[model samples]
Target: MTDRHELILTCPKGLEGLLLEEARQLGLEDAREQTAAIRGFGALEVAYRLCLWSRLANRVLLVISRFPTTTAETLYEGVRSVDWAEHLEPGGSLAVEFSGRGSGIDNTHFGALKVKDGIVDRLRTASGERPTVDKLNPDLRVHLRLDKGEAVLSLDLSGHSLHQRGYRLQQGAAPLKENLAAAVLIRAGWPRIAAEGGALTDPMCGVGTFLIEGAMIAADIAPNLKRERWGFSAWLGHVPALWHRLHDEAEARAAAGLARPPLWIRGYEADPRLIQPGRNNIERAGLGSWIRIYQGDVATFEPRPDQNQKGLVICNPPYGERLGDEASLLYLYQNLGERLRQACLGWEAGIFTAAPDLGKRMGIRSHKQYAFWNGALPCKLLLIKVELDQFVTDNRTAPPQPNAAPAPVEVARLSEGGQMFANRLQKNLRLLGKWARREGIECYRLYDADMPEYAVAVDLYRDWVHVQEYAPPRSIDPDKAQARLLDALAAIPQALGVPRKKVVVKRRERQSGTRQYERQAAQGQFLEVIEGGVKLLVNLTDYLDTGLFLDHRPLRLRIQREAAGKRFLNLFCYTATATVHAAKGGARSTTSVDLSRTYLDWARRNLSLNGFSDRQRLEQADVMEWLAADRGEYDLIFIDPPTFSNSKRMEGVFDVQRDHAALLDLAMARLAAGGTLYFSNNFRKFELDLSIAERYAVEEISAATLDEDFRRNPKIHRAWRLQAR
Candidate 1:
């Protein structure tokens, strides 16, 4: 064997540069960057050190031989020329990995077969015995790289991909690979932060990847120190004593580093289940005492005041790809900005996300942005300074426009239009407040675009308020509209005597497809309110619509009055509000169907909150499919679908205006004879198909469905009563 051999260190696609730097630091000479890999020449000790110490590298390959080849026979002969007995013992188990293709080796599987055959034939000829293959846990792992007519066979010194640190036994929905997580921490400057005694916090840490990796870096522990076995362990060329010495040095360094006051590395997760796995990973990594994982949400997480205040806050918040709706993510990003500003001021934050648009919504401008790949999806790591100035918005307020005549009565200090908007809101609250109390309503809409200029809807849930702004027309000047919105938002708190923070504002616009079903925020703030004697959970900040639909109060009441001793069914049951009402009204049994797991979970919580769990089944399935398959009959059924939905789980896009006829027919099939089916939709332009009215007895009861709160917007939703003739 040569004293100094050529080595190749492979890493993730975008981390080649960092790996090159790491190689240079490991005393490898002439290190150069390649596409997704780094190449250099090093002694055997250097190679062994890299295998044990390099955190960013995926695999360390020591070049055995490279030769030109034009056919599979030549490839086989070239591999045969190498002394296989020097690498693999006779009768040992081995695995071969091949990539690329030469002239005759058109596929990787065949190429690997040729290479394996060459090794086996050579070993059999020399020692009268050949090594068996073991892909799962091999004693020898060989890699062959073919390019054009050239072949390079190298021994894989790292047995498995170094990313499999064996620390994480479980992961969350989307987990960052261990090596990738280490690369992120190195790039995020976690090492430097730790050296300075700065704390590390991950508010949205999933399975504690960042926290575990950060602890390893701070404690100067070898990433693979705890690994049981390596590729070199079973190889003939492995020097056991030298490797043992290096391992002992790493163990001693880790012990000394951890003996000091442990770095303040903490992680918070909203999911309690995730927190346990994170703690388990930390413990498995041998840093459980150094890093702490807790159960908490981003909105409620606060940096421990007793610890260091100048630490880094690193998180990879959801980018709305597999989880959450994009529109609702805006609220989440904005709330993250608020949390950083309020709780983590003067700290640096590194946010890794796939959506730059959502990152911009955080309101903090990045000081430096690094490009990365979270698997195939292109992502960015934004480094922002969480200072007070980043939270301040520069919306210059316009002065009040002078009216032709001054009012004789003393007025509050507000702009002219603001005063008028305030007055209009106050008047509506008085009007709706009276009706709400008399009817036992704890939540109701006070205003719905009453003043066209405001173009906002305000609803009250106990003392908390939810305001939704309607996106204005393109013809309106954006600056003017923003000024008016600020004025209205300011006037809301003063007019209603509610704290500014208690009011959550979300922009209401015409949503397309499943965008309406997306999450708006993850505040997890739910308020309980009574409507017609039934208690329900209502979340005003996390979703586009609150859990309970205020406009549906009249319909729910109607269901209660007519649902005695009847089997009830609710299709597209959001939060199962109608089901809860029916169950309370003495319905024999109820089944609610919806497509969203989040909403179904909310529905279960609402049912459990009301002490009505049994006899009421919540089915999380596509309503359209459920209707077609359901053989059970119901005395009364409620069908309320979104205006349009293109959820990927469904068979096809659902357009209420176009699919109402077929939907009603499906619902009608399950309705018993003389049973009633209440069909409703919020599509303003929806027209019931004429063919449906001809087949069944249909009555348009839209007028009677409107309550006092939705009286002004009579078209808030249209309803009908259907029964078989």
Candidate 2:
């Protein structure tokens, strides 16, 4: 064996520089950074030390050979060139991992197979025995990377990803990989903070990844000290004595570190269910003495360390995956900022978030920002010192006077135009409030472009307000429109007697393709509003339209009133609001169809929320395609399709104006004898096909479908009741 061996340390993207620095610090020579990896030359002892110590590396690959290859045969020849007897026994089990794609190797599986065959053939020829493939716990794990017509083959010295750490068996949704968590801590200055004997806290700890990693850093404990298995565990070149020496040293260092006074390390998770699991993980990591986890909400999170010590408040808050989650996440981030200010005034904070825009809304300024990749998603680590200077405050507000009477709370003052808008809102509330209460409607439109200058729709979902600014015509001055929008936004909270946070605002513009269904924000804030005595969930901030169409309130209620003792079908059922109503109306059965799995999942929730899951079917398919194959008869049918939809899920574009006749014809086929089909659309210029009246009894019910809230905009949607002649 050579005294010096080439080493390649692979890490997550954006961690190469940090890994390179770590490798050099660990006594690796000639360390250099590459994309997502660090390369260096080191002795076998140094390689073992790196495997035991590196917290940012995914794998430590000890390069065996690097050769140019342009075809499958060259790739096989390169793998065969490496002496198999030196690395693995002839009868041992091995696993091959191949990455990159080029030089006639376009598939990783095929490339891995070729490499495995090369190794097997060479071993068989040398010793009359070949290693079998064991993917799970192999004696040898070889890796081959094909890049730019070159294959770099290496023996994987670290097995099962060094990040495994043998501690975390159960984790929360979207748990950060341990190495990535370490990188976040390292970049956030956790090592420096720990070296100073400062405390650490993760307010939104999920299964306590941050807490464990932070504790390990503070205690000088090797991350892989407890790991019993490695890629080199059973290799022919495995130096048991050398590894044992390093392992014992790490053990002694850990014991000495633990013998000292433990650092004040704690984690708080909002989920009660994760408390025990987090503690279990801590105990498994042998960090229970230094770390304590408790069930605590971020809003009330406070780090109470001995002797009033200050440390770091670090958290990886949820970067919402679903739309409408951002609305609630906004408040969550705001609360975290508030808690940091109120409790950790002298402390530092490291906030890792994928959504930097939400980080900006925290009302605190970060001193430093580091870019990182959480898997494929780009994220930011915002470092902030929780000082008075870092607290962002409204510049308009005067500073508090010392030893003076408390000033009265100042309300946002509206401009002349804003006051007019506010007055109009107040007047509408007076008239609409009485009607809403009398009709038992909790969700209703308060104002819809009532004042031309405002050109915005204000909707009341119980106590919350949803304001949508309609894109002004191109003829209108953009600046003027924006000013008017700002005025209306300022006036909404005051006029509606709601907190500013409860008001969700969005801009309404013409959308193309699936843009309308795309999330406007990831707030995931759902508000349940009562309409027609059926409980329904509505997300006011996630998508372009709230889950429930306020304009279609009357139509949904009418469905509820007329759906008893019948099989009801709802097409283009975004969230299945109408289906819920129909089910609540005592329908025998209900089926809702839509192409979006997002909405379909929501529809399932709505049905489940309303206790209508039994006999309630939610199908995820193109409505036009589903209608063609559906053989079940429905006594009552309601279809409210988009004016134009070119979703990739569908075969072709659907223009309601052009295809309404065919659409109605197919829907009529599914209508049972004496069944009634209610067709409605929001297209302002939608015209019912004349041929429909000729073959069926058709009555225009556009006026009847308009509720009091939509009375002003009766053109919001047109409805029709059709029955076969």
Candidate 3:
């Protein structure tokens, strides 16, 4: 076989260009992008060098053979054509990673199995023995690509993705992959920054990916220097001597680089649990002495006094991974902008996020932006120069230059609709304010799209206001709807006498699947509020629906009133607000079930706040799955699932309108004789199946469930009391 072979390097999407640049830097010629993977030509030594040094490439694949293959038999024949015995010893282990689904292969799993079968059969024919497949760690790893009726087989030169630099054993909840982190640093010009003796900081560094990767770049350390194994080490054509020579040269370079004065690197994490893991990663990378991980908040981030003023402040700030996180993360991004402005005057900052719109809230002008990918989510790296001119001016700043044209007045502050919205808000506050105080309700809906133009729901949790903008119809001009939304948001602070910062704005719409429960922020700031004589925790910014659903207050009150020495069950128990009411209502025992750990924690905090630890249970489970398995009977049950949910945590999509009947049947199956099921949903057009009504005694309790605060929008939710006939 020729020592030179066709080569392909796969990388994360959106980083193909970066990988191409990296491949060129590693002396690979004729490098060009091929979908998400890069194609290149290089000799065996060059390929071995890439496996040891290329930071951005995920896998280094050496193309072995290619042939036209459409049917499964052709794919198997193509694989059989390759001399498998030459690559893997009989009775040894092998693995196949198949991508693409052309050539009649409809499933990747099935394609991989066919390739595996070819390898086993060929090896069995050659030596009367077959290599067992090892999915975890195979002696020989083969990659098969099926494209346009063509099958190309290659040996993975890297046993694992090169991004696995063998340094990080622990990571944050959403740490950037090591190679991705390196790419971000490269885009931010971290190597140049460090070479010039500038300091580096990641205010929201998770598990020290950026810091460790930056250290490696600055020290010129080969990314995989610490990695002990490579696919080539076990290959039949392995050139051990050539690899040893390259490894020795890399080791010498790293040792000499480490001897120099270390670059200044710092990482800050708010979660203390991540701090130690970050420190562990740094130590594992042999960068403990160079990079420092600290437990600190981003708002308090300041460059070390001994560090240089100019460097890179890069972080993959918790991008709103869930629907509701965007609102809470707005403040975080704003805080980051503020910190960059006040603390690091000359530093360059890069914020990587999936929701680039949140970058606008950061209050800084991006000098440049680069596209990247975090797994499948399209994202951007926003680069900003941390200087006074880039910072947002204070509201009280001096007027513009005398010769400058007058700026357009903001529509929210002076629009006619703004006044009407404000007036309606004031009227509702007066009407509901007194009622809330008299009833000890610290949180209540003050407005529910009361005005046509102002299509938003405003709620008050004591002093703070939660603003939820209902998505306007396509018939309405998006710009006009946005203007009206801004006007309404502006009106809330003035109308409610709350500070602008105290107002949290989130766009609320009928969510598909599990988007409603996805995390949008990790501020972890919960405010306590009194409701139905119990204190509950509500996180306005971190979630679309604050931990407590204001519309459910009446239903919770009824649960409490009806619970006295009776077992109570709260299903779809978001934040367990209903369970709290039941526990406080003197229930004999209470059980709460939901799938979100974040909400479950909030629920625990709410229960703890009320000092109700007696016999309440909190479980993280899919309500539908839990209901089917539940054999215990409860005297009372509350089922208020989301209108629709498609969370991957659940087995299938849940449409309250479509699945309510089955859901109610499952809940009723676990109900004691004469027990009542208070089934409700926010599906505005929900119609109770007449068949269900005929089989059981059912009463529409929606009207009775609406309190003084929610009467304005009784369609917000529907409720019914069902009993076994």
- Say which candidate scores most in TM-score: 2
Residues 254-365, model 3: lDDT tens digits? 9999999987788899989898888988999999889998888887888655544578899988865553343456557666776877788878988888867667556678
Candidate 1 vs 3: which has more TM-score: 1
Query: How many backbone overlaps does candidate 1 show?
Result: 4
Task: Write one digit per residue (lDDT tens) for candidate 1, span 600-682.
Answer: 99899888888888999999998888888889999999998998998888887888888888899999999998899999888
The stretch of ten residues in a row with the least summed lDDT in candidate 3 is: 396-405
User: Scored by CA lDDT, what does every candidate get?
Assistant: 0.84, 0.87, 0.83
- Arranged by TM-score with the best first, the candidates are 2, 1, 3
TM-score of each: 0.69, 0.71, 0.68
lDDT of 2 at 413: 41
Using alpha carbons, what is the TM-score of model 1? 0.69
| Ten-residue stretch with the least lDDT total in model 2 | 395-404
Clashes of 2: 9
Candidate RMSDs in Å, in order, are 9.0, 8.6, 9.9
The order of the candidates by lDDT, greatest first, is 2, 1, 3
Q: Give the clashing pairs for model 1.
A: 325-518, 325-519, 328-519, 328-520
